[model samples]
Target: MPGTRTNPLRRLLVGRVQGVLNNRASGETPVVRSAHALYPPDSVIWRVHGDVTTMMIGGVTALLLQMLHPAALAGVWDHSTFRSDMLGRLRRTARFIAVTTYGERAAAEAAIEKVRSVHLGVNGVLPDGTPYAASDPKLLAWVHVCEVIGFLDAWIRYGERGMSLADQDTYVAQAGLVATALGCDPVPQTRAEAEALVAAFRPALTANARTREVARMVLTQPAPSLGFAPVQRMLMHAAVDLMPPWAKDLHGLHPSAIEVPVVRAGTMAIAQSLQWAFAGRATPRD
Candidate 1:
């Protein structure tokens, strides 16, 4: 058997995975094994954000959850290319996570600042005449919490089977460092608090035409290439299966009882295959 680096099997698996996650040209690549990264290599965030498959599923879940909030949805609706190029939107977000989680301190901080700057311009009136801004502290907090929780939830479901509450809290705290820098106040320090915050935000999260339309695009968007479509479908189903019951219902999405197990099992098989491909590579590409 060839080494992981030169193995055709490894390259093929890793290539296909990257082709989907790195779907668009973002002009930035994640710095692998940087000794000067913001988080240590052994940190919980690195582990949670490192798995490409679960991160994809979690990311979809996060987007769906985030869009339920009118402000978050408004920001994307008014400023983002989500309607025309959903894959580009996904790539930009995935790149941001990759850089912040795996990039060096300067790069991570730069990514944060870029996003903050962009948020300053992303304000608009909601469909109900409510004013909304992406830079609002509470709204930012909502997005942050949804993302971190979604990622952690996916990791527990597919990547790591038995992560403890304490570790999960650690993951939230570690991930919150970026949120704090971005000026999001009241970031949650624990999974319980995060869940509480989600419930608290419920009064503000609404399901409407815009929300349902975005959800449809998220669920039905085409993958970058035909061969990757199956992987994309599997990830979308798993993400839906991973969503909280309330959020799923808000989006008027139904769970396929029969496909749930199949989706999970298929994702597990894909994840394990990628794990094997990157088994001994010094820097596993997520």
Candidate 2:
């Protein structure tokens, strides 16, 4: 009889991959015994957000779109250290989403309070010397809407399954709660409302030197490691593909006709790979 034995290199590789995929070193653990959760277990938001691939791509899309708003971009330019620590910024954002969506009610509220405190300290003069405050409801609304819309768009385009009309609306409404918590007003309660809000606000968005530079940074930022480059590039292109035409044009981020199919295929492949890798890991919150 052959002895049952596992290759040492195979075991080492499996451990390394698991560590990367499930590491909580930065304190982003989902609370298994929280008294309350932001959304219910069976909610559509949980389903859409649970996928790491779509959420990561959606986050890039959100940041790109959010920069189109001068005030929002100005706020970041004046205060954020994104240039020096892009990965840190991404980790922070991912942590916020994780704790808020999956952590207990108390933890989520604490995270919101911490963010509000940070916003109170983030104020500066724009390039035109127009004063800007992160606490402004209007600016907050713009950021919130861009992020929510991006997440929904990515999930819809690249999700494992199609979300129904009602579920889409539910996702928007559910997400609106987080926006409201962050001091955003006129939070869209449905898909139609969200779309209308985006249309109404388009005139206020623009591309400028700063916006273009930031867009470039988002696309060309160095990956955390060499092995991560190809995946990062794929995610960036996927983000561009998911972006609206006007927004993409604003950033001069046109994917060539030949590149479009490649982007779509790569995005789907990445999304599917992530789904397979993380299966049964993130249990839907109850």
Candidate 3:
């Protein structure tokens, strides 16, 4: 009886996994058509972004980091429906990154234009009556730097171990193209420059009531499916662990020292499972 059930259960699991991996790509018009890929097969951006587990987890970390900026938080607060539509927010971001990094030049430019059109309508007043605009070059730069750095940091910590310094810089520079397209100015092309940009923005970053609420939502949101709940918890823990110490302090998160190793081990286990599940699958450029 156990043998009889094993194959069916395995098929069900694999089907669910395939659906997730195919998100936004299984459409009649895929966001990243293979022939139109901008990044070559061996490009650093492709390698860094191909890991689904790390990228999604890194996205959560990036969201928290980006919200630290008052203007950025105001944009989301006034314009985004993320409180009720977190998955939509995540999917749009994932699609943008996926398309820009792998889609043909024309398609990528189209995606950027779509985002810019949306940004044009997102300007509003903050709680203190200070004005904020999603398209503001300064705010765009903050969001872009936080996101790319978060991705690179996640890849380095969990996905790849021995990337050369040059390759790291290449990934940053390559990611900057999308940022520049979205109207962020002075995109950093090197690790040092990116780090300096982050440092410069630190003085303007703080955790406020809204930031804490968003962090709570990200960490505690129910998994989309019951089967993925355990994996999601592990991933969230890993994301929190990957955050800067100052960020942790800002959010009032004190992940127990003892829990760090446990979270890392669990996250790695999940990431490896994904790698195996996706074995022989197409890379981003493919």
Best by lDDT: 1
lDDT of 1 by residue, 125-219 (tens): 97779898888999999999999889999999988999999999999999889999998878998999899989999988788998899899989
lDDT of 1: 0.85
The ten-residue window of minimal lDDT in model 2 covers 1-10
lDDT of 3 by residue, 107-127 (tens): 888889999999899998877
Better model by lDDT, 2 or 3?
A: 3
* lDDT digits (tens) for residues 64-139 of candidate 2: 9899888899888878999997777876787677778777888889999999999999998877778889999888
Better of 1 and 2 by TM-score: 1
TM-score per candidate, in order? Answer: 0.95, 0.89, 0.90
The total of clashing pairs for model 3 equals: 0
TM-score of 2: 0.89
Candidates arranged by lDDT, highest first: 1, 3, 2
The Cα local distance difference test for each model comes to 0.85, 0.78, 0.80
lDDT of 1 at 14: 76
Each prediction's RMSD over C-alphas, in Å, is 1.8, 4.4, 4.1
